[model samples]
Target: MSSQQSIRQQYGTVQANALKLDEEKAKQSVDALNTDLANAYVLYHQLRKHHWNVDGAEYDQLHDWFGDAAEDAETAADEMAERVAALGGVPVSGPAALESHATVDFEGEDVYDARTSLENDLETYGDVIEAVREHVTVAENLGDYATSEVLRDHLAELEADADDLRGFLADDTLVLESAMH
Candidate 1:
């Protein structure tokens, strides 16, 4: 046999052995990915709702922020699904599956007030960022550096976006306080 074939065979054996030895870790990773994907999907829906329903003095700004947040959540959902498939697991799909796996709560009513919608977004985004940070720690412990790195980047972006929204909401107050000092 060719050297390439020999290497492939050896790698296959190694994978088989690793699977046998660490099946539980792989299962844990899959479960984490499924849960994260579900949370991302729910968050995506919430952001979409906020994008569509927000109205107030800051309607345009809130609308655009919600859209950007939804896009990021969608990207994270896709990435999680891809990672699940890459690890020899089937990606979870369907509304029921997402509902079953999601830890984030979805808002039932459409928020008409822009401030209320923005506050909701800020709260949910913070929760998801915290979860993602914990997941990154778990992935790092598992020596899954790629997953850890991806999650780290995603979490950072989410936190930064949340901070921006919070900052916007407090801009007037902050400016006033700064002038007084």
Candidate 2:
């Protein structure tokens, strides 16, 4: 076979479904979904780093908490990637490729204490939720109901995790702050 014929690629080869909707629009939605997948991976990395590096009075607790968050992020990433494939698009990946599609940056360099880690993870979750919220509409407008549903589910999970983290960070023995609600 010729070099072109022998080439193996996951992208530029997507054959969007003919009977569902506009192929071009489906590809566009898939591209956007791949971006979310990348962003979820970056967020997962942050969660893991914070989980293992956390220190201070609540070291053990935060460590466990971040582990759960990391697991959730991993789940989100896997779902997003699958959705991309289901839409006939390849999942954006690799450290560099993921970074290129990521909606937010990860803090891989700095050493963070428990408080700082919570703040950073909360912020990252917020960013993912924000992007997912927008993608929900984008996916729906493109007639991609499945992708829209995925984005909506992801948005809810991320928001719940963020709320949990915020409550843990803000809940004081004497002053309950906003966690009471």
Candidate 3:
């Protein structure tokens, strides 16, 4: 086995940042950002799964939308990770830590219909939107306006994605019934 990597900074250890935010308060925002980061990754994978498995009369549209949403989730996760690091705390990494920190639930290995998948995505988006809104407040309360602003921008994009999912669900053009005998 190769040599293990040395730790530069340990998790939960907050250092002084150039932003001049209080180190103690920055810890709170860092913790929230890590949690958000984990949730974003969960959403990212779920979106990718739906994108790959989506099928139906609206397959083309849903597939493309899922791909876009997955990109958004990935981009949001990257930004949150950077924010956590900027706050002087080591961002949470690894599957175990991410799963433990994440409040969002995974959709698992089962493949459902396009409508069911879109509904699931909507639910996940709702959960993420709510959590992000709360975390924005947390950052603002702790005087971390930069983090709050970042989350606010992500929140708007997330809401727009969720609305797209809602629209996909609203369309009644999908063939939900099987005619094969």
Candidate 4:
């Protein structure tokens, strides 16, 4: 490990009841939330990838929508990590760590078909939702109400994202004839 790594690892020990939470339970909640943070990071980048590369007659609209979703993911990740820190735990910060810790995987092609792209995005959202729900219970069981509340809100947001994507996919009134011109 580098000197910086040694320093951070050495003094990074979490203290109990720093945030008025049970130290052990807070640490447990933080551990679970670190995984949530990492997965959110993965989903943020994946959403951005689709936002930047998706192609279709509706490229502009989808790109804009995905960009907003990516921003939301980024915010969620940052907030989750901040909560971990607030709970006196170290958030997983390295890309490799984040990737290994993430439950969601990136599977969309560099170029994507519209419905497939939407479906892939929904899958990513769904994966995060599942993880979020699991970790929310962890937080609640630990009496980490702040963390639990944040995660509950995140769950709602993810569901809205999925519902939005599913709605677009279900819309059959799309007309692409004019775009072929």
| The candidate that achieves the highest lDDT relative to the unseen native structure | 3
TM-score of 4: 0.88
Model 3 — TM-score against the truth? 0.92
Top-down TM-score ranking: 3, 4, 2, 1
Question: lDDT per residue, candidate 2, 1-181, as tens digits?
Answer: 4666754446744566644767787788877788888888888888888887877556677789889888988898899888777666677877888898898999777887667778888888888888888889998888888889888888888989988988878756543457434
Candidate 1 lDDT, 82-102, residue by residue in tens? 776665566677898898888
lDDT of 3 at 138: 96
Per-prediction TM-score: 0.80, 0.86, 0.92, 0.88
Tell me which residue pairs clash in candidate 1: none
Better of 2 and 4 by lDDT: 4
Winner on lDDT (1 vs 3): 3
Q: After superposition, how far is residue 26 of candidate 2 from its true place, in Å?
A: 1.3
